[model samples]
Target: MKNVIITGTSRGIGFEMVKLFSEAGHNVLALSRNSKPVSDLKLKNVTALEFDIANEPEVVNLSAYLQKAMKTVDVLINNAGFLVNKPFAEITAEEFKRSYGVNVFGVASLIKTALPFMKTDGHVVNISSMGGIQGSVKFPGLSAYSSSKGAVITLTELLAEEYKETGPSFNVLALGSVQTEMLEEAFPGFKAPLSATEMAEYILDFSLSGNKFYNGKILQVSSTTP
Candidate 1:
């Protein structure tokens, strides 16, 4: 079973992914700003660590902790992200910086730290959004978030090409509106857009296959039945 590192595991999709992967018999290193609530599902092969993803020191400390624990990360899931819903014209510098701080810089920092521990046949999955895709549009207030996701997609593609000769694969999962706390925070008073469990299941299945078809591509999943 693969040893995977997932960020933003305190709740929502990241939390569900930890459960899904651990239940699949994989070792999971779950990271978040807060400790995950105690649960039977978190016992055994799943270990949770609390750290601010936006902080460079915390990311470095986490990397060192994993190394000291003699854990090799076979898969790195850059899942920690944030959304700021405000019109582009009204978005403040602080808002834009915070958006990129978590979505882009934090993800890059974790990947850099984990790359050394990753085996030749390892994998890296960056959790992006459908908003990153070309021509994809969202609520007018989501300019900053959408832009950051777009950057993620670009980073994924560049990394995939850079690691083409390596045995490991790099991919981006451009998720459709998934029901998570982030969604609720972004659009208050709105119903869930998609079930987190269903999306997590699909992601787990895709990750286990170790296929290259999705490499450097955006894989979008939606619950909306057409």
Candidate 2:
């Protein structure tokens, strides 16, 4: 019965999450640059919107949509991410900017927009990567991607602290490799331990109830090392 907002819903985890939430009888606003996939699903409770989080104007439009279609958001999952797999020495400034634009800045802007529409019981979940965790296992050619995700983890903590009294808990999840198209695109032939649906189901449950016990924390949901 809750209104949920999910970004990066064109495919993979975000796509599965939309279906899961809708099947669970919740309303979902699925946002992705390419909305056709979700739109084609035609779920009664899911509304797919063509969204580019990297675009500030689109974020403002999202705010307007929230005001018109939903009075409040029960869950805001910042699942949209941009990854640039390039060696640090060779990574360009534009590449870094594109990475941060979607992974960090977009998450921040979306969270800020959602804050006014979020209640005390709402949750804001920022999706990060195990590579983003300090002291965790690192991967080569992920300087821009991993660093931006790291920034999101820190940003989540600060936001949680700033709005502790007002409520709407903020948390970040540092996930291990999942068998997603993003993974395949980034690293061909690599197989992850979990599937997109499995990971999506875990995240769906956490988004609904994790705020009750945790906030301003980074939960590494990985079978991998620290």
What lDDT would each prediction earn against the true structure?
0.80, 0.94
lDDT tens per residue, model 1, 84-103: 88779998999999999999
Error of 2 at 77 (Å): 0.3
- Candidate 2 has an lDDT of 0.94
Taking all chains together, each candidate's TM-score versus the true structure is: 0.91, 0.98
- Clashing pairs in model 2? none
Find the candidate with the highest TM-score and give its number.
2
Determine which window of 10 residues in candidate 1 has minimal summed lDDT. Answer: 35-44
lDDT for model 1, please.
0.80
Best by lDDT: 2
